[model samples]
Target: MEVYYSKSAKDALREMTCKLIEVMRAESDNIPFNLALSGGNTARQLFALWQEEYRLLIDWNRIRFYWVDERCVSPEHEDSNFKQAYENLFGPLGIPQTRIYRIRGEEDPSKEANRYSELIDQQLPKKNDLPHFDAIILGIGTDGHTASIFSSCHFLLNDIQIYAVSKHPDTGQLRITLTGPVILNDTPLLIPVIGEDKRKILERLLEARTATEDFPAACIVYRAASAFVFTDITI
Candidate 1:
């Protein structure tokens, strides 16, 4: 685990985007730059920066976009992560629809997860016969969840299924999330955590205590993947 502290959230976004551009350029021939996006205020900020500053640097045609998790709603719905990315970055930057691999959340949640897993199995590179993403961008929730894997959702912590259907223990809304095994398979995972509220949970994750169902973020360490944590919060 490596931590990069930025002066502000905006700076962190730019720095991460620059790093991504370099990584993509270096690794383009091996496979298309498969990016798994997370949804939240920090992610929105990063998307905006990509649209404004880093859009041209990315080989949009060769990049395959996927989401780390999604709300079980129509893609056109206001709360939909696909909609948010489309309106904010994909549409504005003219990224081809064919290059975006979105989870069909409006479909049966379980079926949708399976469908995405199959798509990934087909698209991503194989390591030890398992699909491994080139890069996965994630965000840390205040309660220590990543993607839609909430603190109360224990089933998501393991690699049993490629995807899982979960509910926000507090909100009761359905969500489809990539399992930890799917995330950690063979990729470089970047987690951009901002704000003071996330500090304690981030600390706990770094300390590597016993896995708690409530703090699903702790499971990130199990993967043999490299984790880059970009944060603006001071410890």
Candidate 2:
């Protein structure tokens, strides 16, 4: 696990963009770069950067976009992760629909989960019998959850399925999320945790030495092949 501290959210995102550009440039031209993205205020900020100036630095045609998780809502819904990326990143970059693989959040939770699982098998490279994403961007919830895998839903960490259905601990809202095996695979896990609200949780995660049920975000950093965290929080 590696951490990059920035003075503000904007600076953290700028640092993240610089690293992403390095990954993009290093990718093989013969194959598409599979990128899994998470949604939140941090993601919105990152998308805005890409839309503003960073888009020119990326080869959108060689990138295939996927979501780390999605709320069970219509694609047009304001809460939809795919909607956020489409409006802010994909649409602005003129990325084609064929390169976008989004979880069908409006469908039945179980069915959508299975569908997305199959999509991962079909799209991502296989490693150790699990689909390995090239790069996975994620966010840590203030409650210590990541990718809809709340502390209350620890079974998701043991789930062998590529993707599974989850419910928000507080709202009971359904969500489709990639399981632990896929997330902890050999991929570049980029986590940008901004704001002072996340400071304590980040500290707890950093203190943990192994994958623990207490903090789902910690399990990610401990198990992922390479985890990069960019945070404005001073910790």
Candidate 3:
């Protein structure tokens, strides 16, 4: 695990975008670069920065976009993660609609999970019947959750399914999230965690101990792919 402590959230976002551009350029000859995005305050800020600074750094038409997690709400809803990204980044950047793959979270949660799994299996690089992502961006919750996998969510630690349904610990709202197996598959994983509140959990993730469902961020270290941690918190 590598940590980069930037001066502020905007600085961290800029560096992360440069790293992502490099990753995309390296894999340009492949079918398409797969990038999974997480939704939260941090992601919103990052997308805003991408819109202002790095929009032209990569060919948006050649990139495939996926979300790491989504609330079970209609895409038109204000709280929809897809809506946030669309309005803030994708729409402004003129990214083709075909390149964006979103979970139909407003539908039945289980059905949505199955549909997303099938969609990914069709789109992702398949080798020996397993799908692999080119890169994935994740954010850490103050509670140590990543994606919708909360502290008590046990299924996140398993490889049985590509997507799973989980509930927010406080709101009880249902959400769809990619499982750890799918996230850690042969790909580069980037986690950008900022703020002093996340410092303790980030430290635990670097300790390299056995991962428990209680600390979802800890699972990223076990991923076979390269992992990078970009943060603004000081150690």
The residue-by-residue lDDT of candidate 2 on 40-135, one tens digit each, is 888998999888977667777888899999999999999999999999988888889999999999999999999999989987889888898878
How well does model 1 score by local distance difference test?
Answer: 0.81
Weakest 10 consecutive residues, lDDT, candidate 2?
Answer: 53-62
Instruction: Give the clash count for model 1.
Output: 1
Root-mean-square deviation of Cα positions for candidate 1 versus the true structure, in angstroms: 1.9
Best by lDDT: 2
The positional error of residue 49 in candidate 1, measured at the CA in angstroms, is: 0.7
**What does each candidate score in C-alpha RMSD?**
1.9, 1.1, 1.7
* TM-score against native, each model: 0.92, 0.96, 0.93
Q: What digit string (tens of lDDT, one per residue) describes model 1 on residues 133-228?
A: 778898888777888988778678775777789999888999989888878776788888877788787787877644555567767744536777
TM-score of decoy 2: 0.96
Error of 1 at 68 (Å): 0.9
Ten residues in a row with the worst lDDT in model 1?
209-218
After TM-score superposition, the amount by which residue 79's alpha carbon in candidate 1 deviates from its true location, in angstroms, is 1.6
Error of 3 at 48 (Å): 0.6
